[model samples]
Target: MRPVLLLLLGAHLAYAGKHSLKYIFTAVSGDIDFPEFTSVGLLDDGQFDYFDSNTMKAVPKTEWIRQNEGADYWTRATQNLIGTHQTFKVSIQTVKERFNHSTGVHTWQLMYGCELDDDGSTRGYHQYGYDGSDFVSLDKSSLTWTAANPQAVITKHKWEATTYAVKEKAYLENTCIEWLKKYVDYGKDTLERKVSPQVSLLQKSSSSPVTCHATGFYPSGVKISWQKNRHDHDEDVDLGETLLNEDGTFQKTSTLGVRPEEWKNNQFSCVVEHQGKTIRKTADDIITNFESVPIGIIVGAVAAVILLLVIGVAGYLVYQRKKGFKPVSGSDDGSNSSAHT
Candidate 1:
């Protein structure tokens, strides 16, 4: 029941801290486009290191890690990940057999992390999931395993019998927190930096929903809301997931669905809040794309024009050959095909 509660209430298991270090490993079986295994290391929810079955090498995702860590660090990390990869392969099979799953897509996930609060409070967790449901989790206080279902009992007993939980607890409390502190020191400038998002109001047409997109912000936390006639409007609004950008920043979008007549008669605004800064965009800021030609159509038109020009030139050559007129041969003209000659 504890594990089941953890499964249902994820992201609320512990209070969010000022910083966190997490390692997420996923192993998959059956046919899928994704890699068979992947391991990601995150510092404060931003990826700092990554490894996969395809790469078979642990590599830094952030420049700070790249600059701070050397080849020896990567080599050790890679070796550890290789062992983890093999273990995950076997673990997935073991879990599959336990669940009586013979085929199809099955995933065995392990998420373990330590959080450090600004007030010096700390929390650590190690959890496992099978097929997107909780299998078991470590109860650090009692040094026991909490199984979500009967199928996980065997694993729980087997793991408890050995010194696995002891080793894991040690690592989570000591080594994990140590590495987290070192990483925070390494990327303190980037991690603690607060960059305001570039907000934009967009719509494809009058009938389409108005979207407030905020991009290029650090720390990832943001709030987007809609206001009608200067009052908070929550109806017919959709909030999208915050996503990481390639440049290590974050982006988020919130869409408001309202009729054109309603928006025209009433004042509508999108308000974005990030890092203690509030930005509000009114209807005047909405950028409509319906009047603009699509890039595909523009490219096709350009290609069509170029193709017609080429065809016309080729046809003229054919017509000229058909007539009595002929150009002199290259050999007769005393010119070689080689430009240098």
Candidate 2:
């Protein structure tokens, strides 16, 4: 019992502990625009013109008039500034509250557009108002933006910003958990039922090398290496381009070639690295060695051998006992024979 317990303890210790980081990063971008409002006016005549109801006059296109109106209205109201381009950036930061348990925080930033006027200084108040400042925070829980300073208002702006957390531990933990869930849900069928690594050995008579090809999906980056007798061998490795699937997943292939002798005697391994751990599959002539014999086969073979040996030994013992038995069946019969002699 003690020995068995000790063995189990040793086995547990020998099993590699999970290795993982605290965070994962994913980048995404999208187009954002404020809806056009009705207060802004539209351009009607050909000569860079706009109708201003407040002044009760037809005003020529000017910066002051455009500043009060939105960019979409101003651009459409005048032919001079029509077809202008505006670019903005959006940044999101995921903050975690619990190291590996609870959800945390998220921050957002917006940088409005600004440009230099004819006076060699930044102008265009409509575009310049919100420049170089944090505008809002996107609450992850509510999925809505919270204005940092609600009272601060700007007319025309293009915002670019990023939000991140100080304690990255929570972020990493959540990322790892999410990745694990995704891997299990979508990747389990392919990953759990392990496939033997497809291996092909090519030989070259000249100094030129041969290439071996292998294709597989490994959510965790896999290490494809050439080996000789389970030892790492130096060889040229070429990783081909990975193709993304329609489901937003990716698949890649790796190719490597070694000398003919290396392939003949040594074992080659494709090790999949994931979650700070490695799982390996080796091929000798492209065939997989079973990690363990099937339970039914193993039990049947052992039982048959044991039963046959038992029967054979029992029959041999019976034969030996019969052969050795000598009957002193009659002292009387022996005495009669001696008298007759």
Candidate 3:
């Protein structure tokens, strides 16, 4: 089916390193003075280096460029890029028809190399784009765009972009990914290796969702979910994004909705699956383990009581021994103590 088209594209493929592509579209309406425009790019590091589009060159000349740390790199990248400019003139008669001047710009970027472990496999890729100031994200199976502007304006020519993107993506996978593998063997700076994730539960709040959070994870492939009676439950669960932590680890949160009855009945648990093992923690566990300190205090009190009784018994035995002494005065005969004195 059309569900996944690229996976079926090739039987044998070559490799290539650091190859990519991009595109842009602009449309204007309303004022008699209006125009239509669009563009495409092949980029490095998210910036259009060694190349210039009409918008790229003009936007950065002002504060936007100077404030950008990568200004120098992209501006200089033109030397390595191929660029072209076209001018179209409309006679005075056609000017009245174009008005309102709606402009849209979209760009896509990609970077691919061989997996560090396997030459035949790809290290995967980093591919994303921008629709004007908003963001667009894509993967092997999906393409998405988000913006504050109305969806209508954004989707105006979405089909055109989609068709081009699909073709370009297939081109990269079948041609670019493997071709790069020839020259670009993943030695060190390749894809990140997988690491076992740390899993924890967030505190429960009244009327709020119960969250199971995993932090300091790796590979972005771990799973977190809810369980009832040791059984996994997926219904009514929401998974948040897996974001990178400051320490280069990944973190994500999954929320489970519970009815008032479930909380009162203690019917929920958080379970995390990482590295082929499952760790489960339940709300009832908190209540069962929270009083360990109190158990230690009771043991201490019994020890103190036993020590007091032993001391009292020792004191009584000493008094009895003293009372029995009767101070013998003479060496042998049963002489009176008064005579010896």
Candidate 4:
């Protein structure tokens, strides 16, 4: 399992033709048993660098990055992260005071990055959050900051009075985008590689919903749907978000809720599409982990699955804050204003 602290920081999803690079800095205050300060850098939603107050050193998370960057790069990144760590520590206290939070698990985070589309267009963003809520963000075009809450208004005015927005805009539009492109080139083979997903059909019991799970996929572009009698079926379907695996692959699940009688009366199947290939599985392929288990043990098994799903959802929520890029056909310009837990 990934460190809970890292999950609290961010796990960002990747977008399909467009590539992105993001930096996430987190500071915490209270009795929470976690690193007080930590920094993470992601390339196309895959972590490339990470640093925490405990190690006090910046390290690469990918072999390609470690091989391409030298000692000087790590040293410079470490120094910059150390400075940001201290700044975040102070910022956390400032936010606690502003929110009247005296002693609890409070977090202050800053996320900023740039996105490059395959067509050569780019977009940039800089956002801050306090205790899992939006604080403020920079509007590059206007050279101003937008405050999400009243408490952020003070910081907004403070930044607008100085040349902070100008500097940030310059970095996001130029330096950040340049770095993103360079990093993408460094790992072109890995980042651009395509891998098909392994599909599975699962069910806890006959009464439980059937889950279609797909794992070991790359580029994070996949579609899982249900079919009834060779036609598309959408009713009573629960689609899950694509999640990152520790090995740099992705996984997703979609559950179909239908009575056993209804499923028996019709030919139901799960279909997964990725990388120009399709895989289909029918009810006959369902894997029941609870088979032959006692009633009490079966209940426990169900509870365990639910718990895991809850934890996955928590991580998904954290990752959702750092917006990803999109393909050329996508209309979203990789801009999001709100930051939620």
Candidate 5:
């Protein structure tokens, strides 16, 4: 009979262990917030029990039970939930409830308490951390969410900078090309052309002596002189000083002061001596039928005055003939006209 009683006691203890292992709090419908705690019944050894929602486990507080009120029932329930070795297994019902309702909630609280780090240190909260509060609501049907990383943002900025640099370089290159094209076009098309030199002469109507100024830019060397009927007289030819410009071009001018008679029936010319060839251009050649004083008009006016005087004398002689008048030498009487008739 004692052996049978011992067998029954062992069987009862084994059944009790199995029932204790299976006993776990199942979370039903409610808003499950993380890192919260609740009090459960005490264990038979009189210890306090606290349920943690973050770890989904129960923990026994033995020292707490000895120091606080309701130690007997609180300690027993805590021991039953935490087990003998102060370790608890997470309930599947709690895990399922947390997983199903974790669509937009913290899911790290579902981990068993034993799985937590023993150092009691938690990683700081960040956008990608497990305890991060910066989570977007997950679409339950699509099971998708959006996130951003700082590395990707930095890469995008670098790409934009590179593109701007390339564009600036291209703009500078195009501007240089345009400038070169303009320079080449100007150099090829713009140059001076040769033209015949122009000449002009001026004189005063009064007795003032004539003045002559000859000015021109001749690429070829030139000679300018005043001549009387193509004869060179002893006169001073005022040759102006030559000037050299920055562009390697030359200019020359000459002047002469002469009496008015010097231009009488005379031609003044500017002769260009270039490359063993002499080209003579005169001011007379430019002015058609140019003469000093118009001698023909003067002679014609004198002849007209003389002819008119002669005609008047002839008419007085004819009138004397018609009146039958005779003239006597040194006679003052009118009777001499009849004696001559």
Candidate 6:
């Protein structure tokens, strides 16, 4: 039974890397108001998962296809992905999808990756192309598509001997452009319906850097940053990529580092700027150790002591000022005070 289980597990792993799908839509100008993409993965159990590019969330397959008219066009395209000579089996298993609305002109280009596995191992392979276009016979191996590389020397015949071929070429290109217009209009019509994400801050330890996170937002344009001190200035902060949430919303994290070991003494903050809303977080928002209630209580007490110390220092500064005492900047104590995104 143990041997059988291990064999089953091994088989499962090999089958897991089988197939996936993806889509990307971009509007340079006058095509779509915004740009977005979608990715899909095939599961071993024959289930399909869909993800929105902006939110990085796993959307239900039904909802994705229902809203996007381009899906039907792409679906048919996916069914026909082929590469030149089929050397790359992984190409068919993967999808290189693009919907370009460049320079106010939209075009559709897609490729299906193909790959092969030998006892659960794979060698890198290439991809091929196909759509529902009537010109499939002209480029059966997707050789014509290879010219995507700017410097590629490969070129295919543009002029056909017969007038029927000329008409067909025009039709295929026109159809893609028409589809591009439809896709863009659909995006613009639904653009305003997206929701804004909620922003929050979290920390692993009291002294650790704070991570400002935003969740459940749409359209993926939220900017997160860290600022130091109480000034209206921006500071350098480590920014993470915007990712998709499972609910079709967007989320991202921006981490702000502490100043030496006196992070508490130095005022630090995180600001999430999204859709005209400026949400902020400070070191004061920490929840302390969460391992256990006893630990939490202990941490609270420690925090209280730290707070009292800060208050005492502030009071001393006020008293010193009243007595006309000023410390030289370069001659000050080892404590250096400063303040991000």
Once fitted onto the true fold, the runs of candidate 4 whose alpha carbons sit more than 4 angstroms away are 1-17, 290-341
Residue-wise lDDT of candidate 2 within 63-132, one digit each (tens)?
3333444555434433221111111112221111111313322211121111211222221101010212
Q: Report per-prediction Cα RMSD to one decimal.
A: 21.1, 38.7, 34.3, 8.4, 62.8, 25.2
Encode model 4's per-residue lDDT on 120-162: one tens digit a residue: 5667777777765677877878999889899989899887887
The whole-model lDDT of each prediction reads 0.66, 0.26, 0.35, 0.67, 0.27, 0.34
Compute each candidate's TM-score over C-alphas: 0.77, 0.24, 0.40, 0.80, 0.22, 0.43
lDDT for each residue of candidate 6 in 56-99, tens digit (9 for 90 to 100): 33433334334763445444333222111121222212212222
By TM-score, the best candidate is 4
- The candidate maximizing lDDT is 4
Stretch of 10 with least lDDT, candidate 6: 332-341
Question: Model 2 residue 37 lDDT?
Answer: 10
By lDDT, is 5 or 6 better?
A: 6
Q: Model 5, range 221-253, lDDT digits (tens) per residue? A: 345445545666436566543322212123334
TM-score of 4: 0.80
lDDT, candidate 3, 1-341, per-residue tens: 00111111123323322222221222222232222222212111111111223343422222222343354544443322212112111211122222223343212111121122222333222222122222222244453322223432333245236554454445435544343332122211222335665555554445556667666555456778888776778889998755434333456678877775776675688887876867776665422222442443234334433422221222212221322110000011111111000
Descending-lDDT candidate ranking? 4, 1, 3, 6, 5, 2
Please provide, for model 1 over 146-260, each residue's C-alpha lDDT reduced to its tens digit, 9 standing for 90 to 100: 8889988887887778766776666666666666666777888788778898887889887788988787788878999999999999999998756555456777789999999
Pairwise lDDT winner, candidates 2 and 3: 3
User: How far out, in Å, is residue 98 in model 2?
Assistant: 36
lDDT of 3: 0.35
- 247 in model 3: Cα distance from truth in Å? 5.0
Error of 1 at 49 (Å): 0.9
